[model samples]
Target chain A: MVCRVILPRQFRAPELFPQVQREFGRLERIPNHVQFDFSQLQFARPSGVVFLSNLTRYLRRNGCRVTYCGLDPSRDPIAYMDDSLFFEQHCGRRLLDSSQPRPTTRPLMEIRHTEVHGWIGFQLIPWLSASSGVPETELAEFRTCMSELFNNIQDHTEYDVGSVFAQWYPQEHKLEIVVADFGSGIPRTVRTVEAIDSDANAILRSFDEGFSAKSRPTNRGAGLHYLRQNVLDNLGGNLRVHSGSGVVRFEKNGNSHQVKLCEGSGFCPGTMVELEIRTDRIEFDEVNDGSFEW
Target chain B: MVVVVKDLVSSCDTNYDGMVVHKHVLSALHGTDSVVVDFSGIPNVTSSFVNCAFVALLQDFDFAQIRSRLHLQNVNRQIGNLVRDRMKKEAATVA
Candidate 1:
């Protein structure tokens, strides 16, 4: 038996994710052969490509013979993925001849949690510093955010590995980052802490400050709370988390946040965290060094 | 005893590394009146690392004992606050 799932025309994430879950989430028992058709994919964001890469990984790990077809490297969308090194990293095949990542984007990558601190220091921070107004020292603050997500993947997920992609949109003055993994969803991990009604509620409640992202039963800023406080609240940007059959989108309002929910939208395996950070609000935050008081 | 954190060459991000640091520091605490942990070079750290390495000590030692014995040197406000917040939260959760 074989299953063919054609890729979407507009490959954009936080939106493309639910549609994918609806298509592939139910098929835990995948057919022996699975063909991912990228013929219609016209445009793709860095975050969206991370989802696609993780989807392919999950399918293959489930004992399915996965293959991709209907790709034209000459086209912009397929070429973009090639330039980002998505195919080479995900499929061991290059779609284009160039080996460099695109201008404002980092290449799609899979990294283990243990190596994330160094990766952020050596790879991610330098790239962001080169492309933005934020200096490397100040931008290093974002390393805590990455560390939080990586720690969650290490503690909660079946695999300690995570798929990451990032891009800076200079025109929009914003940064979009996607960190994803194929593991048990956030709702399952939350269930271990508190009793919740829906998966969306589970994720929403998990955002409470002082609550650890995983099992420590400690209130730490290194988990979802830091993501909310640092990005959505301070920068007045947006954060989207999709886990299981539910999705929650939080956008910064004047002082608070606007929460949008899409519950019961088919089960999505694992969790994906998307952050749209406002670069204008970005400044060096690690500047205060005077007092260690209190 | 003085511990220079930069010399550890540790990742200081994941729980596994956190546990390693915890064990090392705990061993350093034995038979010593106090241990000074220096963070001159390392600029930032994750809560996960602080939790495993410092907050976990609350399990074995009281806060005052930790305060008297575990003195950190040359840490930024962010690191101080993280240790404080994790300690308060863990104590609250335990209570």
Candidate 2:
């Protein structure tokens, strides 16, 4: 049986997740082939691009033939997604007509599960700095944050692999990074160590300074907390985490931090983290502090 | 004895990258009075690296013993802060 999915018009986090969950459910039930129609997709956030790529990859891995149809180049006109080659690389074809020229320049860096290693910082820092004009000092914080997120995938998730998509929009002065996995969601993982009532509460607890699902010795759960500190608190960025049927968003405004949480309309199989950093507002002084005696 | 962190761990991004070095350091501490983890050549590190390499020691060894027997030397401000922050947070959790 072939499953057909209609892409959402506004593809973004906290909103696009429910649609994705419903579509993913359809894909799960169908065995042979899957077709995704993107004619209705007018706009897509960085997270949406990554989500699509991940979903397509997941479907193909499960012995399903996937195809894309009804993507009108003129109507969609998503420059960032096009520039990033997310559609061509993931869907394995160009969306626009043959006459329309695709962007030759690649705007994003895609990392598969096998390529992640200790030298990832070296690979990411230069690309990020070149794209966003973020100084090496500021990029240092990002390197640490990325390492934590990727490490979580390796340690916490049962999936052997995960994918990360990152792009810096120089015109918009923003950096978008999305990391996703196809393993059990954060709430289910946390439940292995301690009982939790809801996925939303699990997500909230995951951000606590020392909350960890694993046992002692290897259970230092400071990764997400430090990510939140580096991105939202230090760089004044925005963070959204979608896992299972829960979503939590954190944004820094002026000197205050705002957090919002809600239940997803449908269930996401694993976890997706979307972070947006305002490159123009990132200050090195805020990141560079002197040595610590302790 | 002095253990150069850069010489021990080639990269500081992954968890096992740090955990392996932590094991080496733990072995060094078996016979020596103290082991100074020199961070002169290493440029940077993430919390995950530090957690596996240093903070996890809190679970195995007493904090007072770690303070006395394991010394961090030639560390940059960035890594120092990372280690200190993770140590402080883990300490609270363990307490």
Candidate 3:
């Protein structure tokens, strides 16, 4: 029997997840044939596009035959989805709804962990820099922040594939990047190594410097900490991490930082790291001028 | 001996690449008085890279030995901070 997932009109994350989780939260629960009904999807956020693409891949990886229905290229959301390469990455085919992926769209990508460095340096950094006026030099820190998240996903997740969706909004001078994967989340992974009482606590604790999910604990825990520091604290960007049922959001409020931890952000399969960068605000790094400090 | 990071890995990002750098650094240390890791062309690196390439060295060599033997050149604040932060933590644990 086929399970038809009728998506909501506003097809975005932090909301779409809970509804979908009710369908395929566990591997044992996936139906033989899963059909994603995107007819009702009127608005698609980067997070939602990447999440759905990732969920589809996850289902297929678990032996589910995934199919899409109710795609109307004439609709604004469908056209946007086409421009984002959502259907292309999802099915290796495009609706040809738009002339091309468009210059403003970063396009969706399913990058293996091994290819992350190249993707970030060769494609992601250049794309973000081109649209946002964020110098590549200043974006180096952003690259480091992203690399840290990739490191976390590589170390913690069972899947090697990470689906990414990025969009550069030039008018707003903002860049949105979302990377999602089908792996054991921060909570489940942290629970393996430490005695964390809750998912929110596990994610929050991961932010502590020198915390690693490795059972023996190597030099492995700085990914989340550095990400939180650089993206939220240093650069005044936004960072949201969704894994298991935990959601950690970092927002800058005047001089103070807003750290919100939600224990019930629903079940986000694997983990999703979403970043909204104020591309106009990035500046050059002044310290550590190519010298070692002993 | 100078271990140019770009020469070791096309992109300094993954654990496998980090391990590759670690082995090369170990070999360089054995063959020379000191090894300077050149991070000129590499834009940014991850903690996995730093931990495997630099911090793990603390286990085999003390902080003093690391300070004396292993050096970093062209290290930006981003990569340098990751290496230093991780190395300090591992060095403390070893001590």
Candidate 4:
């Protein structure tokens, strides 16, 4: 027996017990003892929780033999399986208002050189902000920019050694995300965007279009470009990039400021991105649901 | 074969009969001469189902063996027209 699972695109899986029962009834001619195969299903929203629960219940009630394949068997199911985890940790985080006294002043958590996975970054940022009482809007922007930067580091930085260290200052209303590695830097990532090794300035120019690096697959290369627009241009944040001894500082709604490279103190062999998101005016209610006692 | 017929959408529950349909259309075409494949209940045919059912069978059976023996019966007007207009495009790619 075969139970072909069709993956739905929408976020919510409306329980269709009637439809499922009808489908099963129509296929009742098949013997009960035959083995059941479930394949080719994809989940689009709320991650996978609702669907899994419904499927498990249906299969159990039917007394059908079932086999599952092709599902991404990640060890930690909650990270991807729970849709709320992404929002609670990323988009809905709280940011301290620019006007209020900072609620949390802890240094940004530092994750150095161990490869930064997407989920880890997704979990870490909001995890850090939980203490700060960040505003929701700022948290959303932070999640977007942070996702782009973390993805860039994962895709671009291929090296012998690497690390990321970050600290968020509530009093200053700024978050510093620093990723450094002793490997190929942005200059190398730039080469794939264009044919020439164009000087550091031209390389920086490539960032304006948010073009993706040709060397990588499935990349929306606009991570840095998006970071530039939302963080700096839209939200009045700051972006600083240092690649191969070339330093460029970008302030929201301002001209690109080029500065002399300091003697490799903040610079090492890889890329270190420092982004300051202003969050001094936001209140705690804006950051969290105000349901948790912590 | 259970065909799920919804206007403009047809989903076939070929779960049990899929293997038979696969074998007839791919290798033993003559083996299915007495049987007619019914997609009347299918309202919409999806790629995921096709990929899971039809495309998968092609891996084990050869096409020439079952082309003529496989038959689609009770094709509804709305579903049939929909198939002609929309599914035809996909059929070309899948075929």
| Deviating ranges (above 4 Å) for candidate 2 | A13-15, A21-28, A74-82, A91-110, A117-119, A215-217, A285-292, B30-34, B59-61, B91-95
Q: Which digits, one per residue and each the tens of the lDDT, describe model 4 over residues A1-294?
A: 465544333322232222333345323432333222213333332213332333333344467554444334231322233222221222233121122212232222224333333333345445555755653333544554554565466555664333343445656756555544334667677776566443346346546543667444323334466567656644556776655544566773345533323322222234555556666533222333212110
Lowest summed-lDDT stretch of 10 residues in model 3 chain A? A213-222
lDDT of 1 by residue, A234-287 (tens): 554788888888888888778878898888765667888887876677655556
User: TM-scores of the models, in the given order?
Assistant: 0.87, 0.85, 0.90, 0.40
Better of 3 and 4 by lDDT: 3
> Which candidate, 3 or 4, would have the higher DockQ against the true structure?
3
Best by lDDT: 3
Candidate 4 whole-model C-alpha lDDT, 0 to 1: 0.41
Alpha carbon lDDT at A9, candidate 3 = 92
- The order by descending TM-score is 3, 1, 2, 4
Q: Provide the global lDDT of candidate 3 against the true structure.
A: 0.81
| DockQ winner between candidates 2 and 3 | 3
Task: Tell me the number of clashing residue pairs for each predicted model.
Answer: 1, 0, 0, 42
Q: What is the DockQ of candidate 3?
A: 0.64
TM-score of 1: 0.87
Task: Give candidates' CA RMSD values in order.
Answer: 3.0, 3.6, 2.6, 25.0
Could you tell me the lDDT of residue A240 within candidate 2? 84
Q: Which ten residues in a row have the lowest lDDT in candidate 1 chain A?
A: A213-222
